[model samples]
Target: MASTSARDDDGMKERLRQLGLRPTRQRVALAKLLASGGHRHLSAEDVYAEARRAGIQLAYTTVYNILHQFTAAGLLREVVVESGRTWFDTNTGPHLHVLDEESGHLQDVAIDPKALPLLNHLPLGDDVEIADVEVVVRVRRRNDSA
Candidate 1:
């Protein structure tokens, strides 16, 4: 049994259409994987591996390309946890993240809408304004054993 029903597939098509991307089979398959999970932060490699396991024979480069396309189209958010490690977050809205260093896990951290800090001081010309902000807090598990 496939996790995506016909209606769900149609919704996925609309999602891509809204992004001005063609709703190909590959895009729909990738979108289903990303959206089926509640809210996910997956690397391109993660998606490639999972797709292979799920019997989708797409190349790893294809996954990266699709992820980048989605990110550029505002369908996904890219969170850089470190120099080379990046996660494609399913949530595109403004939010914060708490990263577990030990397990390499990322989770969304709730932020109070009223508690957001105001950014001041401009280093750019008059035509510049801030549009979006991202904050990631890294954490580690506290050792319980003495």
Candidate 2:
């Protein structure tokens, strides 16, 4: 009988293959880490830290490259909060996000895209089409002592 870790590695390998990405050792390790838990947003540094915790030795740039590669292959979604800051989301489906301004953390929120009135009408040229819509509502902790 195959061990649980072996089974997980095989699954990750198959997933990577299906995405047209070669399943290298490093890639498999990183993919497993990203997909192990439920979908969540993570930065490159976050992934690097996790990899270290898992005893996976690799450079930060390698993690960044693999993340970008995965994003290009549609396996992940890139969220840019501001200049020089980005997060990779495992949930590639259509969803909104609630960002904590103070902590720089991102949490997925369930809100129907149709409910957003701005998407109903856009002032773009007819030749233009919206590929995707990413809505991030930034919030901070309330200061109750007003």
Candidate 3:
């Protein structure tokens, strides 16, 4: 498990380089924002907001471009919730995203691995491998006033 985690780190670094990103301080910070939090579900705007809050000097456009690069490189998963908000997920592995509609926060939900066979029944070709399965569950916060 430890070895696998180390490999993931190395792989991320390589991916940034391959994507033509300099892997500078800002890039590393951005990567950490995604990786360190276990799994994050954030839109480009969300990331930019957090970066600003964290005192990272990178512009919002820079964060957005970096996010697109990461998504293209398979380092992140892009999801659109029912609210029509685009969210970027730090967890690139197979998992489900649970969107908190009330708070606009997203969480990772566990799913049974056995169900993958059923997905194969779809029209997708044999070469297709599921990267991430986004299941945005919408709910409103309970009004305590009631």
Error of 3 at 77 (Å): 0.7
Q: lDDT value for candidate 3? A: 0.74
lDDT of 3 by residue, 1-146 (tens): 56965676576667678877667667777886787677777778778888888778898888998888788877788887755678887776666666676677777777744375666677867797765455666667789997
> Candidate 2 residues 40-110, lDDT tens each?
99999999999999999999999999999999989899999889989999999888999999988899987
Number of the candidate with higher lDDT, 1 or 2: 2
lDDT for each residue of candidate 1 in 1-146, tens digit (9 for 90 to 100): 65647879999899899999999999889988887787788988889998998888888988999999999999899999889999999998778899999899899976742356445444657787667778888999788996
How well does each candidate superpose onto the true structure, as a TM-score? 0.81, 0.86, 0.66
RMSD of model 3, in Å? 6.0
What candidate 3 gets wrong by more than 4 Å, as runs, is 1-15, 18-25, 112-133, 139-146
Looking at model 2, which ten-residue stretch has the lowest summed lDDT? 111-120
Which sections of candidate 1 miss by over 4 Å?
1-4, 112-115, 118-128, 141-146
Best by lDDT: 2
- Could you tell me the TM-score of candidate 2? 0.86
- For residue 33, what is the lDDT in candidate 2? 89
Root-mean-square deviation of Cα positions for candidate 2 versus the true structure, in angstroms:
2.2
